[model samples]
Target: MVKGYNYIVNSFFDYLENRSKAVDSLLCVGLDPHIQHLDKPSAAAARDFCLEIVDSCAKYACAFKPNSAFFEVFGAEGISALREVISSIPEDIPVILDAKRGDISSTALAYSNAVFQHLGADAVTYSPYLGSDSVAPFVRRPEKGVFILCKTSNPGSNDVQILESNREQIYLHVARQSLVWSKHNNIGLVVGATDPYALTRVRDIAPNSWILCPGVGVQGASLKDALISGLRKDGMGVLITVSRAISGESDRAAVAAELCDAINRERESRKQNHTVHVTNNIAVDLIETGCVQFGDFTLKSGQQSPFYIDMRRLASFPDVLNRVSKEIVKKVLDLRFNCIAAIPYAGLPIGTAVSLLLNKPLIYPRRETKEYGTKSSIEGVYKSGETAIVLDDLISTGGSKFETINSLQKVGLNINDIVVLIDRQQGGRKLLDSQGYRLHAVYTISELIDEWLAFELIDNNQFILIKNYLSESA
Candidate 1:
């Protein structure tokens, strides 16, 4: 568990290394299973062919990405075939269910559950144009992941994705927004290898993000240019995907192996490409960790807030927790605080994570002191005359803010800066500022509400209601 995770290695890294291992074995077969290519001319046959390809390629390829539409054509039978095909593959080689689905809350939840549970996918693809609600369900689960569509290998993708806006390509908008989404979930970008420029721009926006790049083989995207455009400074961010050129041929296993070799060669060619500014990569990661939330909820001040934040969710998601903790530490790199204290159970995990990552001592005040031990309200390493940061997931009226600060002060810690994950902006910031405590927040409920509104994730009435509530609360 590097920092705090059950998995020793990162999922993306594992997928990459797993591919490398499979390449050494010589296999990366694409399970397209077009009905025209199948001998039996049935959904079950398609499934059987896919499983056969997996059986043949598992020894050669590290992972399999199954395009959903191929099986969707068969209706219920096709869906069953798809499920069986997924389950038939060797468990060691991860499966990427390539279903580019994007929808709102309930619908998105059904899609996510279908992909992760019914289809048994390690990860699935998502379209981010709908806003956060569409993408939240996948990330909420600890094991699953979401790969966002930034740019595609398809020529028609340029029709909308590459159109100019503010001198920035439409694809760049997708890339930048995906960066924000990636902060909270295991977000990666799907940038086709065919467009080097678009790929580079996506990389610029998300340097640390793993790219699942298609068009490497059949689409005529050169291994040379892809290596040049796709490789990150670390050499591991690019997942060069090839489908037809490898899968369309006889000796599917041998072709898969050859493709893997081709990817490795490309990776070696672009080994020296330096990474660009990815300042918000880790911050976005924090948001994805289920540690961040954006929705309507009542605050302690009896005010209806635009969004509610709960960073404690990070404790259950290691990737998100680590990403957010690291980013928070990066944001506070220059600041000096004598002690770290969280607002009871909610903020304790983040506080502890930051404290450990920064090598700074930690002290969290409890809602109430324990009856046993030191009978102290504060725990861990605390000291006198030291300045402290009050850590809380969300702040509403700044009512509890004083209570938390006072508790820390009682233990001889100086209280000033309050680091909150979300600021309801319903007097919390103003209240903290009036008390001479600088309020730092990752995001505001209003900002989140605006995002929801812009994406049409919520109705105008909900937006107006939230606005009226905040205005009335203020």
Candidate 2:
């Protein structure tokens, strides 16, 4: 496990990350024993074919995905062979059964059992056509993972996937709903590598979720385009699947190694490019949306400043709010929290967006308890001893955050981390650290100013003024 990461393997994604790091590869070798590739159309032949691929490519594979239809064609013997093939793979590498199973809760439970318990596969591809009930059984087990079908690689996917629902595409809706179904943090999406634009859209909606991309070689999809569009800022969110590209080759191991190296080269390049693009875009969006302003203003803390940030304006721009919320999700991805506590007034809408995107519960400490009705200080359902990460628009002196923290702690909720869109580069982070709380931000004041100046959005004078103000405040 990497340092500073909460690497407790409570989910299949966790195990996948560990294996990816150990092997330094994001390649998921596909085990599809088609009839033509096998010596004969028999269960033994299929089993032997996959076993050979596993033996040759296991070292370079972070995961092995065996399509269930190939083995299930041989009936009982084929099913037995499938189990043997799954069990034969190295335990350190995860196995994803490409079954695309979905049904009612009861039937889904049986499918889950057969895949995870009976066959010992760590994850499974699932169909989301029947809705959340069909997904409940598979996602109930936190240790397992479910990759719901979103935008598949088939040519016919556009017929239904691109259909508009409430002014949004069906596939984008699926991407959003995947987060709502991921309460256990074991859900991911199946976005094809063939459509890089769709892949990019899915990444924007679910920035933290793992994506399984198929259709690279046989489907004529470019691996570089998929990685550029799908790789997360940390560069480990995508798993590229290649079936015939490796299986049809004479030296399977050599082909697998070559693919692995190609992926790493692209992954590194994408990581560098994505970081710069996201930061600059966010700075421009904040300015254009009036979230960041330059004028004499009195802040809530009764301090005079050269500029002010009003993130509350984000509520008026749905597109900007969605984009900003996605960036915030990236910062909150690795933090361990049962729910998020949004400071009232400013943090409410941003927190709601993040909660929906991450499928985490949202709670807020009210400014004051009402005299009538329930009169509870906190405005959401939560239990004692549960951990919560605090969310706010920005932090200046840390005075207001403590008020919310105090209210939350009075109700027995534990608070250890706070996340914000921007840090003012004041003493807020130092104060939080002194109180045993860590502060995470998407951007600091200096970084935003630097970006703005570099892009010619702000003049050199304004940049120097803000820089001096930050230094004086410090």
Candidate 3:
């Protein structure tokens, strides 16, 4: 048993991470197998239900959690169905036995053996009330994990969990104590999504510990709140369990994929939102510093715009321009290109700044090839097969950038991506994508304007006026 436990420990975390990537999902499907939810009244029907769910959603799940109470109520047949369901799951994706068994010493030992040895579950949920000794047997293996029920999903959890102890709440004490108990790094907490407030506290208490988050679907827990609070620093390590949410659906696999995508989008949105706020703050400062102007300004396209941003004036503020240049260079360097080229007039200074900062060669692609002095379209010592990232101040309808792309491609420069200070969102992205190029921007005009309005830099009428103009232009 000890030998087998060591093997399970060796593969658990790695298996979880690898399987999650393979499945392209972090949702853990819970197999509770309640009798009424089954198509038929018999235990075989229950077994088939669980089997079908595992078969369908296994490829879209990181783990499968089987709650023991739902199975044990039916006695032997229920237990048999549970065993068959666990055995049917893919070996790489772990199965956590959600048995909230709470006992210390010898009793904990026997339960641990039943869960790990007899049943073949990689992890189990156990009560932490009995202290470290209760969970010691389970952690002795180091590969398997034990999730303590800190602040559960139900409303009744506060009855005992929230009771004050040593001037700290009992739940907080249990949350903090899990760290001391986590000698092997196998400690986790069963934080209910319903109690996002408590879940948040527990997460802070054990940032690196795995959190098995339930109550997302049937329990009506806030998915947004759970994601904001429960995610570990790497944007993962939260096992979201949904039983009826995935299983009850006719298209369970599609539903699982949607949920998985939503979870990842939420994580990504956090990082993106932080960047937008930071960059938007910079844009606001640039405007206040006279680099950008907010008024009726006629753009080069002969269209009236409420705001005008000029990259040339960035030189007026060295401290801000230095930060802006660093940001632009960092983004351009990420492209891993040999050099950078910009559109003639507006993009010259920004492109030169990026090139000098990144220590890369710079080129300015002319509208037409020069009649003399090399008679070249692109003015740079670039060669064929060498890549160049396009730098531009802003994109409007993308016509100018499109012209630059064509001229570069005609002269033998590789341009697969463009870095812009702002995207006008006037159908430029679609055009760029159609030409097999990616347009990475610090902000879209709409995104910047929205930030301006949010920060009260623009009045409601001004905001509405810009929105109306954008609609008319589109």
Candidate 4:
């Protein structure tokens, strides 16, 4: 069991990083044995049809997730049919039994063993509203994964999940709670691809966890919308489940292959568009027009600086900031951090710009909380146990950043990465590294100087002064 457990964890993470070429989305074919549908074709014929569908989709899916409700209606004979159908599929594909079982702990243990040992499934979906007692038993199995229902894809999901207090959405609250529930277990979310809006919400909560999305094809949800909504900034984050559309087609294999091709094509198109949109025309203009300036400049850190970025001017030039924020978000998309912590004053607006542009929550930590309301040190929608990337206008001595990072850490938030519009490189990088943070700068001080020199933005004497200041500061 230990050896098997190690094997599963190692392989699954590897698969998560280098997704299976066979199945891009874990889009499973739903094979419910309807009595009426099976009547015309004998049980043997129905089994043959199911096997043929599997053989057809073999090249297109990572796993074939089966909905148990279809087979359970048949009693013993139906159960027998399910086993035969399962046996027909190959062993390499991970099989997810979408049997959303919610019962006592002991019963769950038995079910877990039955699903993993007897039936040979890699993962099973489960209900967690009953709390951890029922869910933990299955997760304890190590290799097996238990996907909990966080925000479902149904239109009626809002009936219970949307009510709020203190301006917090109920579903968002659930997403936060699930982090604790998912700890130390291979847990994932069962989100419906049809609910495009909810896709971003759930992703905001569990950015690193894999999502199993249903509601493509037969449900009429656009695959394109799912890709845009479900994808992490880095271009991977979900296992899409498509059941009826693929299984019910006349030429099942051909249809499944087409669906696979469609998903891949949609993903590629979205990736390309996302890249171009991030660094769009307005961004190019900013570089061409000197809106993002470069020269011999003095930084607030009391260090001689070589580069200066006037992101503050973006407020007056609304269109350019909009374009810049859009591009910046594209770079930081899917980084899975909690809130966008904008360095106060200059960074506040850009942070707001990014949060508003992406439609994500915003939080700016104050040197001190307001006199009214919650009096929280951090403003906006921020929760503990979540990671966040600190966004700043520029970095120099890194003193201001260290202060900001310290305040966030006091509130139980993880601050390991810092994103800036410009990197002054005047001991800022070394300072940040000493404090344990890696910097992600849009334009390094060196790059800005080089471009400025090439464009004749600065003369040789001015460039020399800037270079001397940077060297002395370091």
Top candidate on lDDT is 2
TM-score for predicted model 1 compared with the true structure = 0.53
lDDT of 4 at 375: 76
| 2 versus 3: better TM-score goes to | 3
Q: Give a tens-digit lDDT track for model 2, residues 218-297.
A: 99998976886677768889999999999999899999999999999887654554356545388899888898899788
Whole-structure CA lDDT of model 3: 0.79
RMSD of each: 21.1, 22.1, 14.0, 20.8
Q: Provide the overall lDDT of each model, using Cα atoms, as 2-decimal numbers.
A: 0.71, 0.89, 0.79, 0.69
Q: Which of candidates 1 and 4 is the stronger one according to lDDT?
A: 1
Q: Roughly what TM-score does model 4 have, to 2 decimal places?
A: 0.56
At residue 258, give the lDDT of candidate 1. 68
| Model 1 root-mean-square deviation | 21.1
Descending-lDDT candidate ranking: 2, 3, 1, 4
Q: Write the residue-wise lDDT of candidate 1 on 1-474 in tens digits.
A: 121134555544455455555444222345787878788778888888787777767766656788888899889999999999888776666677898999998999999889988888878888888987788887775446688888988879978887888998878887887766544447778888887766766766787787888887777877655655556665566777766776577887777766666766655433421232334443344445544444656755565555555655668977666766775676577667877787777788888888888888888777778999889988877678989887777787788889878888888889878887667676888877887888888767766654443333444445555655666877
Choose the strongest candidate by TM-score: 3
In angstroms, how far off is 215's CA in candidate 2? 0.7
Which residue pairs show collisions in model 3? 9-143
Lowest summed lDDT window (length 10), candidate 1: 269-278
Off by over 4 Å in 3: 1-11, 274-474
